[model samples]
Target: MRDSFEHVYQLLTCYFVKVRLVDPDFVFDIQTTSCKDKRFTWYFWCFGHPTKTYKLLRPVVMNDETFLKGRYRGSLLTAIAIDPSNHIFPLAFLMKDSKTTESWT
Candidate 1:
């Protein structure tokens, strides 16, 4: 069992090393915690231009659905326009079981 754990650990270490090699300018961190309960974290960001790059590239139409993972189950759909820098613009959120392009946008 110990050998198997070590083997997987080595594989994960190599994966992170590859990410670093490809994105030397940006920073990436992956954290796992189990103090009270297991939690996983990951974040990635790039060194970018001084000016806000999130200019609206074009008019956007989006439709997505989300649901509760656990208790108080409900579903919602969100439609949004995103900008050039990956920022949400012209955004709207709605809760529905079903929706359409005309109804959302």
Candidate 2:
């Protein structure tokens, strides 16, 4: 399963690069401990609107995490902010092998 995910990972890398080029505020990062290791961690964030329009949004923000029970067990952290119009906007996302203070922070 990990081998099969290689292709998808490559596609996502390309997509992320393109998105960053198109939207300067689109930020993403992939981190690894060893250069030869296949295991890595990543996060995504968008500041395009957040930097400019955050003041227009309500002060209410929510965050949550969902655990995955698959081969590569992990958790996805997501944050959403409520806009003045009562719309929920995804503020950021993070993928970690486990939930911890280090990962969540």
Give all candidates' CA lDDT scores.
Answer: 0.44, 0.71
For model 2, how does the per-residue alpha-carbon lDDT over 1-105 read when each residue is reduced to its tens digit? Answer: 145555665566677788888888787777655678756565465546566767777887799989867565777888889887778888887777666576656
The per-candidate count of clashes, in order, stands at 0, 0
Residues 5-35, candidate 1, lDDT per residue (tens digit)? 3364345546656656875643334444456
Q: Highest TM-score among the candidates is held by which one? A: 2
Could you say which candidate leads in lDDT? 2
Clashing pairs in 2: none
How much lDDT does candidate 1 score?
0.44
User: Looking at model 1, how many pairs of residues clash?
Assistant: 0
In candidate 2 the C-alpha lDDT for residue 61 amounts to: 77
